[model samples]
Target chain A: MDHKEFIRGGTALSEDEIKSGKIFVEEDALDCRYAWDTGVAIGRYLAELKKGKIIAKKTNCCDRIMIPPRMFCELCYRPSGAWTYVQDTGVVNTFSISNIYYDASRVPSGEPNPMPAVIEIDGASKGMGIMHLLGEVKPEDVKIGMKVKAVWKPESERTGSITDIEYFKPY
Target chain B: MRKVAVVGAGMTKFARRALETPKELSYQASKAALDSAGMKLKDIDCVAHGSAPDAFDGIHQKGEYLADGCGGWNKPTMRVFVGGATGVHAIAHGWYHVASGLADTCLVVCEEKMSSAMPHAQAFFLTIFDAITERALGLNLIWIFALEMKRYMERYGYTKEDMALSAMKNKNQGLKHPASQFYGGNELTVEDILNSEVMASPVSRLDVSPVSDGAAAIVLASERTARRLTDKPVWIEGVGWCLDTAYWATRDLYYPRYTEIAARKAYKMAGIREPHKEINIAEPYDPFGYKQLHHMEGLLLSPKGKTVELLRDGHFDMDGNLPMCPSGGLLGVGNPIAAAGTLKLCELFWQLRGEAGERQVPGNPRLGVAQAWGDLMQVSSVVVMGINNA
Candidate 1:
């Protein structure tokens, strides 16, 4: 409610009478930095990804293999039971080919237009999937239930992270 | 009226961003609460969901969106909103559902994802101002809180070090909390806080709680269901709330009149006269350092203008007579808005049940109080809790 904090500041940049022979514009880079925790389920999943394998948690009660694993199973209010490996190969549940970046900048024709997709991995419960980028395929070619496999970095380059899997492409 | 008691509590590790979707966060916290109560979604007769400022999550009608995650699928569900007070208010909302014989059990869930807001969550706070008179002012929470801190300091002659102590105490207490999602392990000193970069005069960067994305939930049940659920139940002894005028400019910045009124109503329902002597612990919403002292006075836990003296004497520490923010409160645990507010009540539940683990205070503390303030410094929500009082 106090207007004094806003009004008592330096001169506005657009003033015709420039102060100190400079037009100093205020820079309010309001973007904030965030470090998100993956928790135990995703934490272990990422570790498995570093080893060139996909992992999921087996729910104790519902007996479903959950993707992007977590500590507790939402279905039955029970802690997840087992860490089971899943096939790198998956079937595309859905997809979208984006020709622009998040900020609406055009994706240059020289570079690959990112094809983001929901890929339902084999061995996971039906329709249990992850959203990832699809590569090595054309926009018109990618269709529902199209089989795809993860493209991984060399073992030496693996850093125990999600990016270990470069992208998914039709095998 | 049927008696209601909290039988279980749970929370996710707070962080700058949860990385998981808001629904997933709600699911985790809700699952934990239900698991702690040895129950399932089917056992919950209703749900009370709370979130503050849709701008934080960037989703409208988030309550309905989160209903299934909160175990409210096809069940009676209510969404509560009142800015920062949504946490305590939602719990009270659930309490009434059980207290009014409308439900045998209610699951209260609160979540916030401030990191989803672009630029910064503070940007959304700017929109909460009075449009015609205040929107063009470009003010943020820090600016307003700084003004209030200045008023309190000038009135009581309190120094920065005096305010800094609250931050110091809470941060140290946070080390024991695994869910203290924002802060890394650091035992802070008052001098470290006072010397930190000043956001506004008397309000340093360390004075404020970090923006966080997380969720918390608690399970409430009627006396019959409560007895069958757990050996120990924390009774909801009292619940009260009040909203003052949004014309914060006209109100005195030195005190929160609404919180006092809210506390009085809660105290009367709980049948308490001497809150300072009766209540063993308190969590009074410390999103800022001085606010701990400011709200301590407002909650009537500390004499007006003398909170600094008690703070200086280590009266609000873990081993002190009355441990405030023993769950590290919001300043240390990270404030995910509604989730953090609900976490305060969850802290009281855990403490009263002797289940606080590393953060447990001595003396087998029984009675406790939690208060949340929000919305242009106008709204206050208060809840009094106890054990063996049912």
Candidate 2:
């Protein structure tokens, strides 16, 4: 008959206990399944990545190729068409320093925090970027505009997921 | 020309947590408003309910789920959302119903149930980021605000002390408001805010609004019904609402241009050239301490970037030249998303009728404006009202 009992995670106590100030209940369940439809363009892009290839949609309006092809250009909101290839190298545009674990509920609860970076993927035009975890560098040593390279997972281990690349480290 | 007036209003007993379901809360509030308006659920031609997000309640299709609770059963009912602005937006929509002759009386309700979500409310806010982009950046919702606060401070040459002054003034007013979350608190000092736990750099825990569970509702009726309902029906003199583009990164962060545009539209309709001199009271949305100053700047009641100075000079206090947020605002009144905005409308109603005992602003105050801002700094909704002619 308590609200906390219906909640997904953590210990449940009686309302009387909480009201009496004898206990404070906190739930910690992080089980979240976000069902999202990636649509036609993105679905194809993900399939290509699974085949060990990268695809960028070409836009006639901007005369440029965009990664994770969108239905419309983010800048001009025009239609984009056809997949193109770009080398796996790009420069960092702007980045932030993060010293936190990616997700506690998704991973082992007590593991150490992961170093993360929003890297500008290589082979793309300037300012095009991807957010990938950063490894091999000390948290205190990470700086904005730092050069880094992606270290992909083994061919046997690659899944089309974002975790396909183990992390980005110093080039 | 058809004119619409607010016939009735109701709200839940605000609290940090409400044991009842949002439907139950909505039923409670809506029933009161309908009863006060001397109308039945069937009398409502249209119903508009505002809830900020499905994420807050952890229920998808929130509008559909909340529909029946708002008396939407088998009639024309729709949900309006603009983050924190949804509450006022609901009223604006209701005004259209009566003013356009589409409906004789409209039921408008705003509800938020922050307690229904798992973990803390802050945890739910983590999803506001692009999972692949900003999530890995170790960014909390506080980070965005802290960044904005830092930028606002740097650009406006506002010290943390000036921001603390707002906390003091609002909290003092909160003491009188029964529903205020921060009521009866000792005066906060500049050192208090700086020393508070830093959720993100420059944004202390004290700077944020509390997650609240509540609901508020109002009934808007045509001019004929307004005379029958009550002697003091508040008239909707002007309304303006607008949304900005979603590309927040490209836009300037210091000033809220959308609010200015929305205010201009509302003021033009209300036929006011000098807002400070003409408009007697205001309730500019203040989810955070510095946001009051930021929105005041956007409202143009104060000169560009000069609100902190006005606030410092006691210009916006309860008895100042232009009284603001006599209801204690989202900061003190507890931010229940959509309900917070409707609470402002309720405050305006109470203030204009001289019914706001203890919290009432001085003078024969007549016209007042309530504005709500939300949606990643993109949306603004304004409603200007006046006391019904005696």
Candidate 3:
């Protein structure tokens, strides 16, 4: 049996077809809002970040210190033992130098390429990291295992969010 | 457990922009699948629908909206989701419906109208990130793949040229696929890919699959129902799906442990210890050029850091030792997320039954595997299928 005979062509709508209302189109925006609870662990972690400090949740079951602190241990499934302050310094786990914007449009010429990295925080277990932007260095200079420090906003400008640390830079 | 087989499969031509609404696309594929099975909507006992986020379609509760089109007016219906894994997972759900003795016949449908999210389909992709932590950093979906591609290349010592082979081969194969969105039937060289404009570093425009609007469907039935319906039934030998933690940052990006676990589960159920020797053809998801290699490693089809070598040696070519992506895959066929993954299963169904016309691999291919990876590099869904020679 010819599979081609079973497959059907999709209806392609041209701009004129839509404009002439030959093809009906609905116009609306998704205006959904979400106010997610930060929960105990992340809430406290955010509070510490607002004070210009990086904190992690420590688990007694194992010596693992989890960044972006969680209330429960993922491996042991037990409540985290305590909150430990980790250094703002970290090593880049992996990085990307993107010339495209979020919507996939090309970034304008002469603008700095956005460099994002998964930086494994110092004093945390191996590979315990968070996603953030990189700054204060050329895109070419960013390397895996490159030591970096958080570039925090001014104390007055700090918000209780991950943006509290503006970005990470070469320490 | 009872046996389940795929009696029929269908897919619409993938396009960048489709005039049909999400429901219409679902109806087209579902009706074609039913027609291929020589069955009617009234004959189906249940409907299993799979789609990605409702944000892309701009319709909330998209499953409920797509129900009637998929022949779920009064039948037992369910929607399965696991990011991009939803398509294969939906088929797994249909298999369960038949194998569990709850239903004798089931219809599995997957649809994605990425063009509906105007300006760009990627805008909806941004919401998949962590709300409190990752989103504020101004990260986009491409960044994660770029980072992983960089890591995979660095760890394996593979080059962009090595990855481009997949892009070139898949696109060349797409020439034969009628449902492919980018099927210009043109040949592309590695230089063509290397010279393509860079979207993310190490990931050029050619490295990624195009966002597409499409739908695909398959009809599944129990042993008795399948025997009655068709002489050439493709059996669903095994199914597996696994997900890693949402804390994607902490894990190593070079290899997909979740895909390994999922493949292992499926292989165990299929009673196959060695996938490389046992599985004849493989359709590992290839949204990006390197991802085919990444998932091949995860599927244990190739050893760690060995896929590129095999690829360069023509091991994974359509006529090579182990043919990969004989249906052109997402890179050539177009990627409508959930729908694209389901399309892989359709290819396997066609290939196992020797029904795949121009894209059919040489040799009487008896067994094949289709796998999908999604959700921030977390989930993996796999299905092993074979012809019912008995």
Each predicted complex: what DockQ? 0.01, 0.09, 0.77
lDDT of 3 by residue, B1-390 (tens): 899999999989998888887888999999989999999999999999999998887778998999998889899999988878888888988899999999999999999889878889886778889888888876777888999998899898889898888788887787788898656667878899889999888899998888889999999999999999999989999999998999999999999999999999999999999899999999999999999999999999999999988998999987887999998999988999999899999999888888899888889898999999887779999999999554
- Using alpha carbons, what is the TM-score of model 1? 0.69
Per-model chain A TM: 0.80, 0.65, 0.91
For model 2 the TM-score comes to 0.77
What is the TM-score of each predicted model, taking all chains together? 0.69, 0.77, 0.98
> For every model in order, what is the iRMS?
24.7, 10.0, 1.2
Docking class of 3: medium
Candidate 1 local lDDT, B1-390, one digit each (tens): 889999888778887755567788888888888878889999999999999997676566888787877788899898999998989999989999999999999999998877667657776787787543344334566656765776688678888888898787887787667687533486888889988865545567788888888888999999999999888989999999999866454456679989999999999999999999999999998899899889899899999999989988989888998899998888888888898889898889888877787788898998999999888778999999999834
TM-score of chain B of 2: 0.95
Cα-based lDDT at residue B166, candidate 1? 79
Cα error, candidate 2, residue A139 (Å): 11
Order the candidates by TM-score, highest first — what do you get?
Answer: 3, 2, 1
In candidate 1, how many Å is residue B82 off?
A: 0.7
- lDDT by residue (tens digit), candidate 2, A1-171: 111111111122345766797755455444677766657776676566666566677787887666656677766788886677665444433332322222212224355345443455555545456545667776566555578766666777766655656677776
CAPRI-style class, candidate 1: incorrect
lDDT of 2 by residue, B56-99 (tens): 77678899999988899898998988888898898998888888
